[model samples]
Target: MFDFVPTRSDGDALREYAELFRASFPDAGHLNETYLKWLYSENPSGKVVGFDAYAEGRLAAHYVTVPADVFIQGVRQRGLLSLNTATHPDFQGKGLFTELARRTYERGAELGFNFVYGVANANSTPGFIRKLGFQLVRPLDAKISLGHVAKVDWPAVCRTAAFRRQWTEAHLAWRARNPQNAIRFASNRDGVLTAFASTDKPGVVVAGEFSPDGPVTALPCASVPILPRLFIGLLPEASRRRGLAIDVPKALRPSPLNLIYLSLDQKQKTLPADQIALSFLDFDAY
Candidate 1:
């Protein structure tokens, strides 16, 4: 029989969890105690809700939900991002993952989390939908506009998107001040600062508020698009970029990814398929 614990209590469990993760996914980045503490304990939203299953006095399976404040149509909704899940190799087909998820989500709902979302890869997408009741939102595609953005006449516009982080002054400052990673800038006369993360590849815009003429072309950019605008894309880059390839009619595409969500609320809700947009900064991927 498996005994499930609701929270992580020691460094040994973390060490074992990291070992299992490394063994299961050889290419994944190393998750040390520091990073684990930073990610699971120190997120801006809230402490992560975790579940661990032990069989015969040994840790056998694990699941966790990382909390995030999701903004939809400018309204704040408390949500959890379903993060890393792992099972011991010896306990592969015992329905442990589903069991852990069910319990964790039950706890999540009690904690006032209304939804759980994640960018699902091919291997896990089917299982999440088929077994865990996760709904497929859409197949993620890259919106790569290579040319310079056209300046709109309006001073600023409201951000429009289904799933966005509620950006505060502190978050914006942290993102803009990062020297090694993404940097926000004002590209035009209006003071809206669009965000671009400098990568090995060309700079990718992770967060930007757009108008009818499209996203702002410059930075010191408008201080937060104040009024309701026509469009917004709220995607932060997920780590496994290999799966998301966007192919327009004439453009050659890379790989592709899919978005999925598990709603904790009783009422069924769906995302706006066409308006969905995200950036590398959105997920733990980049």
Candidate 2:
């Protein structure tokens, strides 16, 4: 029998998790304690929720999800962003991931989390959808822009998307503190857009157009951009009003990312890809 306990957010525990993570993915950069602490401990949305299973006093597997608030029909509701999960090599065929996820969602529902969502890669998409009963919303589009993004209507986009991420100053700030990617921002007369230097291509800057404050009004942008290079994110239909972005070749991407969702309350929900506003900042993949 496996012993289960709530995942801890302490330094030592995070370090231990990182160790197991490194054992699975050796070249990972986000293995430092600082990154783990910021993600599981310092997130403003809420503390981490998941479980760790032990067998004979050894950690057999670990899984966790972070809390987030999403706007559904203009009302805020609790949500969980399905995140890290790892099991030792010795325990690979035991179906630990499915079991751990099932346990996590049960606790999440008890704590008022309405649903769970995540960006899954090609290899894991099957397990999430077939084994865990997640809905395949859509795949993230890969686009490349040359130092350009036309004026965007954030409020309109938010409303059209039906599922909107509630972005507060605290949550945005917490997102900017990622140790692995030094997320920067450039604010002009229009509004704030998060940016980060991309290592895949030198001199290529990935940017996300987002309104940090409320969407009461629209902001104007200068004809010029400070770090005009390439923009990568969910560019709403409004963004195409006047911009130059071409679809990036699928061959360039390591793997296609698909958005997956599961309703904890067993209520059906629809999240159209064209409507949701998402960026690398919204997920941990970057």
What are the models' TM-scores?
Answer: 0.71, 0.89
Clashing pairs in 2: none
> What's the lDDT of the predicted structure labeled candidate 1?
0.61
Candidate 2 lDDT, 1-286, residue by residue in tens: 7888889999779888988888877877677678889899899989999999888988889999999888765567888999899998888889888899999999999998999989899999999999989998888877776655555776576656556677776776677677777566656456555445444566666676666645422222223334445544565564346667677788988888888888888654656566667777677656
lDDT of 2 at 238: 48
lDDT of each: 0.61, 0.75
Q: How well is each residue in 55-89 modelled by candidate 1, as lDDT tens digits?
A: 98877888888887666555678888788888878
Candidate 1 versus the native: TM-score?
A: 0.71
